[model samples]
Target: MRRSLIGGVLLAIALYLGAGTLLFAFQRSLLYFPQPRAIGGPDRLLMLPVTDQQIAVTVRPLASSKALIYFGGNAEDVSRSLPDFAEAFPDHALYLLHYRGFGDSTGRPTEAAILHDALKLFDKVSALHSEVAVVGRSLGSGVAIHLASQRRVARLVLVTPYNSILELAQRQFPIFPVRWMLQDKYESWRYVPAIAVPTLLIVAERDEVIPRWSSEKLFAQFRSGVARREVIVGAGHNDIGGRPEYLSLIRSGI
Candidate 1:
């Protein structure tokens, strides 16, 4: 019985190490959900030069001084949101990022790469427009928090935002050593404290992906006077944008 118990313990330890190794190797695959552009394509696709590669962006360009840089959810094609955004803010210019591997962008997606691309997009837009606002949804909220922390953003909006992807992964895989295993931690909590711009956090009343606690925790991290939280009644994590109040709240923030 003692020998059997020893064998079982060793087997469990081996499995744990193997699982962690696998998680580290293909972690980005789990974190990013890339999709091709929908239908006929965007109004205008912008090519951005970053390091050795060029990333793509869908632009609803306007000759305006105020612009909005939008980062979309995992599995979302940001080009689809352009029409609605164009109608909502007719006077302002819009630039929707097609994350590294998604849409027409080249190369694999990673947290570090996405964040770097976001900064590049902002800088490019800032030159053409005097004021630049940022809006990020779901997984993209993680990108927005990091961008806001490092840049001087005019306005910031996060829809279905979470405190950190690491916390969510830990909750979902309670048995696994997510802290040590996961690669793209996306700890938005570490970035929120530095975001000083007037920010709005929109939550789904029934967000199945992100817990309400996660949103609340992130909201609480923002500088006292710079943050606002709004919940759309009867909305889910993905359907928040469909609500009439969604655009209204976003317009009010900017």
Candidate 2:
């Protein structure tokens, strides 16, 4: 009986150690995917005023229309959506920003850095167009909320978003002390109350990454009475842009 207990204790210790080690190794991948390769397409690079970071702004060159600024998912090359956004809003000017680390953009993508970039890009877009709207998906929703709160955005769209990174981490690693460990706090729910723009919160019913409850929670926090719609339907967290409903929602705003 003593021998069995000793063996069981050793096995338990081994399992605990192994789990902890694996978690530490794959933590970065869980947080971000930093790929800094040149992803070329049919878009001109427009350098924002008072910053070294040059944004690859793709415009579908319309005669007269509004402008839409789209923030990409955490692991996406937001530029790929340029063609579709251009096609969808052919009349409206479309701009897709490459986050600090994604595509050929310089600098690292931190919460503060992305917020500053959004502010700078908003200024640049406002200068060229009369009406400006912001669209953010997944991680980008955090950026969209921040911009909506500060900038004069005519409309805002958030797709498959979370309340905050801290809340998300808590869900994934319930045992781990993530509140103190996490560095990027993409807190969108906190900023939603301050935004007075017409907002559309889109959620993927079958989202495997972000829970539907998170988006619902954010919607509940919004104080703005300016036309808010919650789209709960098809498409996963990553492929939300391909959905026909998503395009229709944007078109309705335009």
Candidate 3:
């Protein structure tokens, strides 16, 4: 009987180690959900040349000094938002990025790659427009915050933001050592203190993906009076864009 008990313990340990190995190997697959571009044509798309890869940006061209750059959620098709943004901000030119591996962009999505692409896009846009506002939603919030820390953004908006992707992963996979294995930490709080531009955080009252506490934690990281938080009543993580006040709040922010 003691032999059987020892054997069972050994089996459990082996299984746990195997699971950890698999988690570490394929962790990025769980983080990025690449989606195809649903809208835009050759005329409306801008092919941005990066290091050995051409990134696609859905653009609304307007000859203006004010511009808006948008980063989207993991599974979002950023092209879909172009029409609404064009109508709302007629005076401002719009550029919405398709992350690496999403839409027509090439290369795989990673924390470093996405942040690098964001900086490239910002530098290109800021060169054309004197003032630029940045908006990011969900996973893209981390990318946006990091870019804002490194750039000179005129205004900033984050929707359904979180303190860090690592925290979320740790909460979801409590059995795994996520802190040690996570390749893309995306610690937005680390960049929030560096943001000197006016910022707005749009939160969903009933966000199921990112907990309200996580968003509040990120908000608290901002220097006092540098950012404001707005909650959309009866909104969830995925459906907050459908809320009546969503675009209006964004308009106010940028």
lDDT of each: 0.90, 0.76, 0.96
Model 3's alpha-carbon lDDT is 0.96
lDDT per residue for candidate 2 within 224-248, as digits (tens), equals 5754655657767767677778877
Q: Candidate 3 — which residues are off by over 4 angstroms? A: none
Q: Which ranges of candidate 2 are over 4 A from the true structure?
A: 1-28, 35-43, 49-55, 58-65
Tens-digit per-residue lDDT, 1-254, candidate 1: 99999999999999988887787787788878899887335458889999988899999889999999999998899989988998999989999999999999999898889999999999999999999999999999999889999989999999999999999999987888889877788899999889889999999989998988999999998888999999998999888889989999999888
By lDDT: ranked, best first: 3, 1, 2
Error of 2 at 14 (Å): 11
Which has the greatest lDDT? 3
Order the numbered candidates by TM-score, best leading: 3, 1, 2
> TM per model?
0.94, 0.83, 0.99
Clashing pairs in 3: none
Of the two candidates 1 and 3, the one with more favorable TM-score, higher being better, is 3
Worst 10 residues of 1 by lDDT: 37-46
Give Cα distance to truth, residue 97, candidate 3, Å: 0.4
